[model samples]
Target: MAQVQVQEDPDREERITMEAIVDAYGSEEQAMGWYYYLDDKITFPFQAKCIQARKVSPLKLGEVVEVTAMAPADDCEREMFVLIRWVDRELAVPLVQLEGIDVDDETEEAIADWHYWMARGYELG
Candidate 1:
Protein backbone atom coordinates (compact mmCIF):
# COMPACT_ATOMS: atom_id res chain seq x y z
CA MET A 1 0.00 0.00 0.00
CA ALA A 2 1.11 3.56 -0.69
CA GLN A 3 2.01 5.48 2.43
CA VAL A 4 1.41 9.21 2.93
CA GLN A 5 4.43 11.01 4.26
CA VAL A 6 4.20 14.23 6.27
CA GLN A 7 6.85 16.89 6.10
CA GLU A 8 7.64 20.43 7.36
CA ASP A 9 7.44 23.75 5.51
CA PRO A 10 10.63 25.64 4.46
CA ASP A 11 9.73 29.13 3.22
CA ARG A 12 10.43 30.69 6.57
CA GLU A 13 13.47 30.55 8.85
CA GLU A 14 11.69 29.17 11.91
CA ARG A 15 10.42 25.59 11.89
CA ILE A 16 6.65 25.54 11.23
CA THR A 17 4.65 22.36 11.53
CA MET A 18 1.20 21.88 9.99
CA GLU A 19 -0.93 18.78 10.31
CA ALA A 20 -2.86 18.79 7.03
CA ILE A 21 -6.34 17.31 7.14
CA VAL A 22 -9.74 17.73 5.54
CA ASP A 23 -12.45 18.88 7.92
CA ALA A 24 -15.22 16.86 6.27
CA TYR A 25 -13.29 13.60 6.14
CA GLY A 26 -13.67 12.41 9.74
CA SER A 27 -15.09 13.31 13.15
CA GLU A 28 -13.27 15.45 15.71
CA GLU A 29 -11.04 13.81 18.39
CA GLN A 30 -10.31 11.01 15.93
CA ALA A 31 -6.53 11.81 16.14
CA MET A 32 -6.72 12.02 12.35
CA GLY A 33 -9.62 14.40 12.08
CA TRP A 34 -8.94 17.48 9.96
CA TYR A 35 -11.17 19.66 12.06
CA TYR A 36 -9.46 18.65 15.27
CA TYR A 37 -6.40 20.66 14.35
CA LEU A 38 -8.27 23.37 12.45
CA ASP A 39 -11.45 23.84 14.44
CA ASP A 40 -10.88 26.70 16.91
CA LYS A 41 -7.30 25.56 17.48
CA ILE A 42 -6.23 28.65 15.55
CA THR A 43 -8.25 31.67 14.63
CA PHE A 44 -9.46 32.24 11.10
CA PRO A 45 -8.37 35.17 8.86
CA PHE A 46 -4.93 33.95 9.76
CA GLN A 47 -1.97 33.33 7.51
CA ALA A 48 -1.85 30.41 5.09
CA LYS A 49 -0.32 27.37 6.78
CA CYS A 50 0.45 24.90 3.99
CA ILE A 51 0.98 24.95 0.29
CA GLN A 52 0.44 22.12 -2.19
CA ALA A 53 3.67 20.90 -3.67
CA ARG A 54 5.47 17.78 -4.90
CA LYS A 55 8.60 16.10 -3.51
CA VAL A 56 9.43 18.91 -1.09
CA SER A 57 11.38 18.87 2.16
CA PRO A 58 9.30 17.97 5.21
CA LEU A 59 10.47 21.09 7.01
CA LYS A 60 9.30 23.74 4.59
CA LEU A 61 8.09 27.08 6.00
CA GLY A 62 4.61 28.49 5.49
CA GLU A 63 2.35 30.93 7.36
CA VAL A 64 -0.96 30.10 9.02
CA VAL A 65 -3.65 31.47 6.67
CA GLU A 66 -7.42 31.43 6.74
CA VAL A 67 -9.55 31.55 3.60
CA THR A 68 -13.22 31.34 2.73
CA ALA A 69 -14.23 28.00 1.22
CA MET A 70 -16.66 26.97 -1.48
CA ALA A 71 -17.97 23.51 -2.33
CA PRO A 72 -16.24 21.76 -5.19
CA ALA A 73 -17.51 19.16 -7.61
CA ASP A 74 -16.78 15.47 -7.03
CA ASP A 75 -14.47 15.11 -10.04
CA CYS A 76 -12.91 18.52 -9.54
CA GLU A 77 -9.44 18.69 -8.08
CA ARG A 78 -9.81 21.34 -5.34
CA GLU A 79 -12.04 21.03 -2.30
CA MET A 80 -12.16 24.73 -1.35
CA PHE A 81 -11.42 28.21 -2.61
CA VAL A 82 -9.39 30.80 -0.76
CA LEU A 83 -11.47 33.96 -0.90
CA ILE A 84 -9.48 36.08 1.52
CA ARG A 85 -6.49 35.17 3.65
CA TRP A 86 -3.61 36.85 5.43
CA VAL A 87 0.11 36.11 5.61
CA ASP A 88 2.44 36.67 8.51
CA ARG A 89 4.25 39.49 6.81
CA GLU A 90 1.77 40.38 4.12
CA LEU A 91 -1.64 41.53 5.23
CA ALA A 92 -4.73 40.65 3.20
CA VAL A 93 -2.74 39.60 0.19
CA PRO A 94 -5.35 38.71 -2.31
CA LEU A 95 -5.12 35.16 -3.67
CA VAL A 96 -7.37 35.09 -6.67
CA GLN A 97 -8.43 31.83 -8.28
CA LEU A 98 -7.00 29.92 -5.34
CA GLU A 99 -8.32 26.41 -4.79
CA GLY A 100 -7.41 23.90 -2.10
CA ILE A 101 -6.27 20.43 -3.11
CA ASP A 102 -4.31 17.52 -1.75
CA VAL A 103 -0.63 18.30 -1.54
CA ASP A 104 1.69 15.95 -3.47
CA ASP A 105 4.45 15.83 -6.04
CA GLU A 106 2.04 16.17 -8.92
CA THR A 107 0.49 19.28 -7.39
CA GLU A 108 3.91 20.80 -6.89
CA GLU A 109 4.92 19.87 -10.43
CA ALA A 110 1.81 21.42 -11.87
CA ILE A 111 2.42 24.61 -9.89
CA ALA A 112 6.01 24.71 -11.06
CA ASP A 113 4.94 24.15 -14.65
CA TRP A 114 2.49 26.99 -14.46
CA HIS A 115 5.12 29.24 -12.96
CA TYR A 116 7.58 28.20 -15.64
CA TRP A 117 5.10 28.90 -18.39
CA MET A 118 4.18 32.26 -16.91
CA ALA A 119 7.74 33.44 -16.74
CA ARG A 120 9.08 35.63 -19.57
CA GLY A 121 10.81 33.83 -22.53
CA TYR A 122 9.75 30.37 -21.30
CA GLU A 123 7.67 28.54 -23.85
CA LEU A 124 7.10 25.07 -25.31
CA GLY A 125 8.69 24.48 -28.66
Candidate 2:
Protein backbone atom coordinates (compact mmCIF):
# COMPACT_ATOMS: atom_id res chain seq x y z
CA MET A 1 0.00 0.00 0.00
CA ALA A 2 1.34 3.39 -1.03
CA GLN A 3 0.04 6.87 -1.49
CA VAL A 4 -2.20 7.16 -4.54
CA GLN A 5 -2.32 10.12 -6.88
CA VAL A 6 -5.97 10.43 -7.75
CA GLN A 7 -7.27 12.61 -10.56
CA GLU A 8 -10.51 14.28 -9.69
CA ASP A 9 -13.24 15.27 -12.12
CA PRO A 10 -16.02 16.87 -10.12
CA ASP A 11 -18.34 17.84 -12.95
CA ARG A 12 -20.49 15.80 -15.28
CA GLU A 13 -19.16 17.72 -18.22
CA GLU A 14 -15.63 16.86 -17.20
CA ARG A 15 -16.47 13.23 -16.63
CA ILE A 16 -18.24 12.85 -19.95
CA THR A 17 -15.30 14.44 -21.66
CA MET A 18 -12.79 12.15 -20.00
CA GLU A 19 -10.66 10.05 -22.25
CA ALA A 20 -12.77 7.07 -21.33
CA ILE A 21 -16.04 8.70 -22.28
CA VAL A 22 -15.20 11.38 -24.81
CA ASP A 23 -17.08 9.58 -27.56
CA ALA A 24 -19.87 8.46 -25.26
CA TYR A 25 -23.14 10.35 -25.12
CA GLY A 26 -25.64 7.96 -23.55
CA SER A 27 -25.72 5.84 -20.45
CA GLU A 28 -24.98 2.60 -22.27
CA GLU A 29 -22.11 4.12 -24.17
CA GLN A 30 -20.66 5.68 -21.05
CA ALA A 31 -20.90 2.36 -19.27
CA MET A 32 -19.05 0.64 -22.07
CA GLY A 33 -16.48 3.39 -22.17
CA TRP A 34 -15.78 3.07 -18.46
CA TYR A 35 -15.77 -0.70 -18.78
CA TYR A 36 -13.04 -0.74 -21.40
CA TYR A 37 -11.04 1.94 -19.66
CA LEU A 38 -10.96 0.00 -16.42
CA ASP A 39 -10.34 -3.27 -18.25
CA ASP A 40 -7.31 -1.71 -19.83
CA LYS A 41 -6.07 0.07 -16.73
CA ILE A 42 -6.43 -2.55 -14.04
CA THR A 43 -4.08 -5.51 -13.72
CA PHE A 44 -5.55 -8.90 -13.00
CA PRO A 45 -5.17 -11.13 -9.95
CA PHE A 46 -4.69 -8.25 -7.57
CA GLN A 47 -5.89 -8.40 -4.01
CA ALA A 48 -8.74 -6.07 -3.10
CA LYS A 49 -10.52 -5.29 0.13
CA CYS A 50 -14.14 -4.41 0.41
CA ILE A 51 -14.36 -0.77 1.34
CA GLN A 52 -18.13 -0.51 1.51
CA ALA A 53 -21.02 -2.87 2.19
CA ARG A 54 -23.84 -3.37 -0.27
CA LYS A 55 -27.09 -5.31 0.19
CA VAL A 56 -26.88 -6.69 -3.35
CA SER A 57 -23.25 -7.72 -2.98
CA PRO A 58 -21.99 -10.52 -0.77
CA LEU A 59 -18.86 -8.74 0.33
CA LYS A 60 -18.66 -7.03 3.70
CA LEU A 61 -16.42 -4.34 5.08
CA GLY A 62 -12.80 -5.47 5.40
CA GLU A 63 -13.38 -8.63 3.41
CA VAL A 64 -10.53 -9.44 1.08
CA VAL A 65 -10.86 -10.99 -2.37
CA GLU A 66 -8.61 -11.74 -5.29
CA VAL A 67 -9.80 -9.75 -8.28
CA THR A 68 -9.26 -11.55 -11.58
CA ALA A 69 -10.87 -9.69 -14.47
CA MET A 70 -13.63 -7.36 -15.61
CA ALA A 71 -17.13 -8.79 -15.74
CA PRO A 72 -18.85 -8.99 -19.12
CA ALA A 73 -19.65 -5.76 -20.93
CA ASP A 74 -23.38 -6.44 -20.92
CA ASP A 75 -23.28 -7.03 -17.18
CA CYS A 76 -21.52 -3.70 -16.74
CA GLU A 77 -24.09 -1.65 -18.60
CA ARG A 78 -24.69 -0.03 -15.24
CA GLU A 79 -21.68 0.04 -12.97
CA MET A 80 -18.26 -1.52 -13.24
CA PHE A 81 -17.75 -4.96 -11.77
CA VAL A 82 -14.77 -7.27 -11.43
CA LEU A 83 -14.57 -11.03 -11.14
CA ILE A 84 -13.40 -12.02 -7.70
CA ARG A 85 -12.58 -15.43 -6.27
CA TRP A 86 -15.00 -15.99 -3.48
CA VAL A 87 -15.70 -19.05 -1.37
CA ASP A 88 -16.27 -22.04 -3.66
CA ARG A 89 -16.94 -19.81 -6.67
CA GLU A 90 -16.34 -16.55 -8.46
CA LEU A 91 -18.52 -13.51 -8.07
CA ALA A 92 -18.93 -10.17 -9.75
CA VAL A 93 -18.63 -7.29 -7.29
CA PRO A 94 -18.91 -3.60 -7.89
CA LEU A 95 -15.55 -2.07 -8.64
CA VAL A 96 -16.48 0.95 -6.54
CA GLN A 97 -16.97 -1.31 -3.56
CA LEU A 98 -13.42 -2.63 -3.42
CA GLU A 99 -10.02 -1.06 -3.01
CA GLY A 100 -6.83 -2.57 -4.29
CA ILE A 101 -4.35 -3.61 -1.62
CA ASP A 102 -0.62 -4.05 -2.08
CA VAL A 103 -0.98 -3.84 -5.86
CA ASP A 104 1.33 -2.23 -8.37
CA ASP A 105 1.10 1.50 -8.99
CA GLU A 106 -0.74 1.10 -12.27
CA THR A 107 -3.50 -0.97 -10.69
CA GLU A 108 -3.62 1.32 -7.70
CA GLU A 109 -3.92 4.41 -9.83
CA ALA A 110 -6.66 2.89 -11.94
CA ILE A 111 -8.77 2.03 -8.93
CA ALA A 112 -8.12 5.42 -7.44
CA ASP A 113 -9.31 7.06 -10.61
CA TRP A 114 -12.61 5.20 -10.42
CA HIS A 115 -12.98 5.99 -6.76
CA TYR A 116 -12.34 9.62 -7.37
CA TRP A 117 -14.95 9.60 -10.09
CA MET A 118 -17.49 8.15 -7.69
CA ALA A 119 -16.52 10.52 -4.91
CA ARG A 120 -17.41 13.31 -7.26
CA GLY A 121 -20.97 11.92 -7.50
CA TYR A 122 -20.79 10.53 -10.99
CA GLU A 123 -23.03 7.59 -11.86
CA LEU A 124 -23.66 5.43 -14.91
CA GLY A 125 -26.56 3.29 -15.97
Candidate 3:
Protein backbone atom coordinates (compact mmCIF):
# COMPACT_ATOMS: atom_id res chain seq x y z
CA MET A 1 0.00 0.00 0.00
CA ALA A 2 1.30 3.45 -0.87
CA GLN A 3 1.74 5.78 2.08
CA VAL A 4 -0.18 9.05 2.07
CA GLN A 5 1.49 12.08 3.59
CA VAL A 6 -0.60 13.82 6.27
CA GLN A 7 -0.02 16.92 8.34
CA GLU A 8 0.12 16.42 12.08
CA ASP A 9 -2.60 17.71 14.38
CA PRO A 10 -1.82 20.71 16.56
CA ASP A 11 -3.41 19.62 19.85
CA ARG A 12 -2.33 16.02 19.97
CA GLU A 13 1.15 14.81 19.17
CA GLU A 14 0.61 11.33 17.79
CA ARG A 15 -3.20 11.15 17.84
CA ILE A 16 -5.56 12.61 15.25
CA THR A 17 -9.23 13.45 15.80
CA MET A 18 -12.17 11.71 14.13
CA GLU A 19 -13.11 14.89 12.27
CA ALA A 20 -9.67 15.01 10.75
CA ILE A 21 -9.88 11.38 9.75
CA VAL A 22 -13.32 11.98 8.23
CA ASP A 23 -11.98 14.92 6.30
CA ALA A 24 -9.40 12.61 4.77
CA TYR A 25 -12.09 10.01 4.09
CA GLY A 26 -12.80 11.88 0.80
CA SER A 27 -16.32 12.30 -0.60
CA GLU A 28 -17.52 9.00 0.82
CA GLU A 29 -20.59 8.91 3.08
CA GLN A 30 -19.55 9.93 6.58
CA ALA A 31 -21.66 7.46 8.56
CA MET A 32 -20.83 3.89 7.53
CA GLY A 33 -18.39 4.29 4.64
CA TRP A 34 -15.33 3.29 6.65
CA TYR A 35 -16.81 -0.11 7.40
CA TYR A 36 -17.60 -0.60 3.71
CA TYR A 37 -13.99 0.09 2.76
CA LEU A 38 -12.75 -2.41 5.32
CA ASP A 39 -15.34 -4.99 4.26
CA ASP A 40 -14.02 -4.77 0.70
CA LYS A 41 -10.47 -5.37 1.87
CA ILE A 42 -11.23 -8.26 4.21
CA THR A 43 -13.62 -11.10 3.50
CA PHE A 44 -15.67 -12.34 6.43
CA PRO A 45 -18.53 -14.80 6.84
CA PHE A 46 -20.72 -11.75 7.46
CA GLN A 47 -20.63 -7.98 7.02
CA ALA A 48 -18.22 -5.87 9.08
CA LYS A 49 -19.53 -3.25 11.49
CA CYS A 50 -17.70 -0.10 12.50
CA ILE A 51 -17.32 -0.19 16.24
CA GLN A 52 -16.51 3.16 17.71
CA ALA A 53 -14.35 2.65 20.74
CA ARG A 54 -15.56 4.28 23.91
CA LYS A 55 -12.06 3.92 25.21
CA VAL A 56 -9.09 3.20 23.02
CA SER A 57 -6.97 0.37 24.39
CA PRO A 58 -4.50 -1.80 22.57
CA LEU A 59 -5.97 -5.19 21.67
CA LYS A 60 -4.25 -8.38 22.81
CA LEU A 61 -3.67 -11.34 20.55
CA GLY A 62 -5.06 -14.83 21.32
CA GLU A 63 -7.91 -13.12 23.09
CA VAL A 64 -11.51 -13.73 22.11
CA VAL A 65 -13.51 -10.62 21.34
CA GLU A 66 -17.15 -10.15 20.45
CA VAL A 67 -17.60 -7.81 17.52
CA THR A 68 -21.09 -6.68 16.43
CA ALA A 69 -21.19 -7.06 12.67
CA MET A 70 -22.99 -6.91 9.35
CA ALA A 71 -22.53 -9.41 6.50
CA PRO A 72 -19.68 -8.71 4.12
CA ALA A 73 -19.90 -12.09 2.46
CA ASP A 74 -21.58 -12.57 -0.91
CA ASP A 75 -24.20 -15.10 0.20
CA CYS A 76 -24.98 -13.42 3.52
CA GLU A 77 -26.27 -9.87 3.88
CA ARG A 78 -28.28 -9.77 7.12
CA GLU A 79 -26.76 -7.99 10.12
CA MET A 80 -25.60 -10.36 12.82
CA PHE A 81 -23.50 -10.26 15.94
CA VAL A 82 -20.19 -12.03 15.39
CA LEU A 83 -17.52 -13.01 17.82
CA ILE A 84 -13.89 -13.37 16.75
CA ARG A 85 -10.88 -15.05 18.25
CA TRP A 86 -7.59 -13.22 17.93
CA VAL A 87 -4.24 -14.95 17.59
CA ASP A 88 -1.13 -13.96 19.47
CA ARG A 89 1.68 -12.00 17.90
CA GLU A 90 4.64 -13.89 16.52
CA LEU A 91 8.36 -13.40 17.05
CA ALA A 92 8.74 -10.15 15.12
CA VAL A 93 5.65 -7.91 15.16
CA PRO A 94 4.65 -4.30 14.73
CA LEU A 95 2.21 -1.95 16.47
CA VAL A 96 -1.59 -2.23 15.98
CA GLN A 97 -1.32 -5.58 14.20
CA LEU A 98 -3.20 -8.58 15.60
CA GLU A 99 -2.21 -12.00 14.28
CA GLY A 100 -5.71 -13.35 13.73
CA ILE A 101 -6.17 -16.23 11.33
CA ASP A 102 -9.89 -16.73 10.65
CA VAL A 103 -11.01 -20.21 11.50
CA ASP A 104 -13.86 -22.54 10.59
CA ASP A 105 -17.38 -22.08 11.99
CA GLU A 106 -17.10 -24.60 14.83
CA THR A 107 -13.84 -23.12 16.05
CA GLU A 108 -15.12 -19.60 15.54
CA GLU A 109 -18.18 -20.25 17.76
CA ALA A 110 -16.04 -21.93 20.42
CA ILE A 111 -13.81 -18.84 20.56
CA ALA A 112 -16.63 -16.30 20.82
CA ASP A 113 -16.91 -17.02 24.50
CA TRP A 114 -13.51 -16.52 26.14
CA HIS A 115 -14.44 -17.79 29.59
CA TYR A 116 -14.85 -21.34 28.33
CA TRP A 117 -11.50 -21.29 26.56
CA MET A 118 -9.59 -19.88 29.52
CA ALA A 119 -9.40 -23.28 31.16
CA ARG A 120 -9.21 -25.19 27.90
CA GLY A 121 -6.30 -23.22 26.48
CA TYR A 122 -4.23 -26.38 26.70
CA GLU A 123 -6.96 -28.58 25.21
CA LEU A 124 -5.36 -28.23 21.79
CA GLY A 125 -2.60 -30.49 23.04
Candidate 4:
Protein backbone atom coordinates (compact mmCIF):
# COMPACT_ATOMS: atom_id res chain seq x y z
CA MET A 1 0.00 0.00 0.00
CA ALA A 2 1.14 3.53 -0.74
CA GLN A 3 0.89 6.32 1.80
CA VAL A 4 -0.50 9.73 0.91
CA GLN A 5 0.27 12.81 2.94
CA VAL A 6 -1.90 15.86 3.29
CA GLN A 7 -0.53 19.12 4.60
CA GLU A 8 -2.57 22.09 5.70
CA ASP A 9 -1.53 25.65 4.96
CA PRO A 10 -0.33 27.58 7.98
CA ASP A 11 -2.28 30.66 7.03
CA ARG A 12 -5.56 28.92 6.31
CA GLU A 13 -7.15 29.80 9.63
CA GLU A 14 -6.01 33.40 9.47
CA ARG A 15 -7.28 33.74 5.91
CA ILE A 16 -10.65 32.38 6.95
CA THR A 17 -10.83 34.77 9.87
CA MET A 18 -9.98 37.72 7.66
CA GLU A 19 -12.59 36.64 5.13
CA ALA A 20 -15.24 36.50 7.83
CA ILE A 21 -14.32 39.96 8.99
CA VAL A 22 -14.60 41.29 5.47
CA ASP A 23 -17.95 39.64 5.03
CA ALA A 24 -19.32 41.07 8.25
CA TYR A 25 -18.07 44.60 7.73
CA GLY A 26 -18.61 44.88 3.97
CA SER A 27 -15.04 45.92 3.00
CA GLU A 28 -12.31 47.38 5.15
CA GLU A 29 -13.35 50.94 4.32
CA GLN A 30 -16.68 50.44 6.06
CA ALA A 31 -15.23 48.55 9.01
CA MET A 32 -14.89 51.49 11.35
CA GLY A 33 -17.79 50.35 13.52
CA TRP A 34 -16.81 46.69 13.32
CA TYR A 35 -15.16 44.56 16.01
CA TYR A 36 -12.68 41.73 16.17
CA TYR A 37 -12.68 38.59 18.31
CA LEU A 38 -9.80 38.10 20.69
CA ASP A 39 -9.21 36.31 23.97
CA ASP A 40 -12.49 34.48 23.50
CA LYS A 41 -14.40 37.75 23.59
CA ILE A 42 -15.13 40.79 21.44
CA THR A 43 -13.71 44.12 22.54
CA PHE A 44 -14.02 47.80 21.58
CA PRO A 45 -12.21 51.07 22.26
CA PHE A 46 -15.04 52.86 24.05
CA GLN A 47 -18.02 51.87 26.13
CA ALA A 48 -21.14 51.40 24.07
CA LYS A 49 -24.50 49.69 24.12
CA CYS A 50 -24.61 46.04 23.19
CA ILE A 51 -27.16 43.24 22.99
CA GLN A 52 -26.88 39.52 23.59
CA ALA A 53 -28.69 36.67 22.02
CA ARG A 54 -31.91 35.57 23.71
CA LYS A 55 -30.75 31.96 23.79
CA VAL A 56 -27.20 30.82 24.49
CA SER A 57 -26.08 27.22 24.38
CA PRO A 58 -23.02 25.72 25.98
CA LEU A 59 -19.99 26.24 23.79
CA LYS A 60 -16.48 24.91 23.89
CA LEU A 61 -13.94 27.18 25.49
CA GLY A 62 -11.44 27.48 22.62
CA GLU A 63 -13.59 26.81 19.63
CA VAL A 64 -13.15 29.00 16.52
CA VAL A 65 -16.40 30.62 15.47
CA GLU A 66 -17.27 32.77 12.47
CA VAL A 67 -19.13 36.06 13.02
CA THR A 68 -21.23 38.08 10.59
CA ALA A 69 -23.08 41.38 10.83
CA MET A 70 -26.74 41.43 9.88
CA ALA A 71 -29.01 44.37 9.19
CA PRO A 72 -32.25 44.48 11.15
CA ALA A 73 -35.55 43.90 9.37
CA ASP A 74 -37.90 46.82 8.73
CA ASP A 75 -39.92 46.10 11.86
CA CYS A 76 -36.90 45.62 14.10
CA GLU A 77 -35.82 48.21 16.61
CA ARG A 78 -32.05 48.22 16.30
CA GLU A 79 -30.21 49.09 13.11
CA MET A 80 -27.67 46.26 13.12
CA PHE A 81 -26.66 43.07 14.89
CA VAL A 82 -24.13 40.25 14.62
CA LEU A 83 -24.58 36.57 14.05
CA ILE A 84 -22.08 34.18 15.58
CA ARG A 85 -22.12 30.86 13.78
CA TRP A 86 -20.29 27.68 14.64
CA VAL A 87 -20.38 24.00 13.81
CA ASP A 88 -24.08 23.39 14.27
CA ARG A 89 -25.41 26.44 16.08
CA GLU A 90 -25.87 30.17 15.60
CA LEU A 91 -26.37 33.03 18.02
CA ALA A 92 -27.36 36.67 17.58
CA VAL A 93 -25.44 39.33 19.48
CA PRO A 94 -25.90 43.06 19.57
CA LEU A 95 -23.33 45.25 17.79
CA VAL A 96 -22.55 47.04 21.01
CA GLN A 97 -20.96 43.97 22.50
CA LEU A 98 -18.31 44.19 19.78
CA GLU A 99 -15.68 46.84 20.22
CA GLY A 100 -14.28 48.81 17.34
CA ILE A 101 -10.54 48.39 16.70
CA ASP A 102 -9.64 51.26 14.41
CA VAL A 103 -10.75 54.53 15.91
CA ASP A 104 -7.74 56.49 14.61
CA ASP A 105 -6.69 55.10 11.25
CA GLU A 106 -8.89 53.77 8.49
CA THR A 107 -10.33 50.32 9.01
CA GLU A 108 -8.51 48.98 5.96
CA GLU A 109 -5.18 49.54 7.64
CA ALA A 110 -6.39 47.85 10.78
CA ILE A 111 -7.65 44.83 8.89
CA ALA A 112 -4.40 44.53 6.96
CA ASP A 113 -2.36 44.81 10.14
CA TRP A 114 -4.52 42.26 11.92
CA HIS A 115 -4.36 39.84 9.03
CA TYR A 116 -0.60 40.20 8.92
CA TRP A 117 -0.13 39.03 12.49
CA MET A 118 -2.90 36.48 12.47
CA ALA A 119 -1.59 34.85 9.31
CA ARG A 120 1.60 34.19 11.17
CA GLY A 121 -0.30 32.50 14.01
CA TYR A 122 0.07 35.31 16.51
CA GLU A 123 -1.99 35.21 19.69
CA LEU A 124 -2.52 37.91 22.27
CA GLY A 125 -0.93 37.41 25.68
Q: Which candidate number would show the highest lDDT if scored against the true structure?
A: 2
Query: Could you estimate the TM-score for every candidate?
Result: 0.24, 0.84, 0.24, 0.26
Worst 10 residues of 3 by lDDT: 90-99
Write the residue-wise lDDT of candidate 1 on 1-125 in tens digits.
12323232243112111333323343222222322332223233322344433232121235334454321222112211223433343222212222224434443333332232223222111
Clashes of each: 17, 0, 6, 2
Kindly give the stretch of ten consecutive residues in candidate 2 with the minimal lDDT sum: 1-10
Higher TM-score: candidate 2 or 4? 2
Q: How far is 120's C-alpha from truth in model 4 (Å)?
A: 37
What is the C-alpha local distance difference test score of each model?
Answer: 0.29, 0.82, 0.28, 0.36
Model 1 residue runs over 4 Å out of place are 6-33, 53-125
Error of 2 at 76 (Å): 0.5
Q: What is candidate 4's lDDT per residue for 1-125, written digit by digit as tens?
A: 11322333456445535643444434332232233332113322322222222233233433333454342332113222446564676565434233343333343343334434433543322
The digit string of per-residue lDDT tens for model 3 on 1-125 reads 22323333344321122321244344233223333433333334332222222122234434434332332332112111123333443121111122224545433332222112222231111
Q: Residue-wise lDDT of candidate 2 within 43-103, one digit each (tens)?
A: 8999999999988799999999999999989888877889999999989989989999898
What is the descending lDDT order?
2, 4, 1, 3
Task: Highest TM-score: give the candidate number.
Answer: 2
Model 1: weakest 10-residue lDDT segment is 71-80
Clashes of 3: 6
Task: Give the distance in Å from residue 21's predicted Cα in candidate 3 to where it truly belongs.
Answer: 8.5
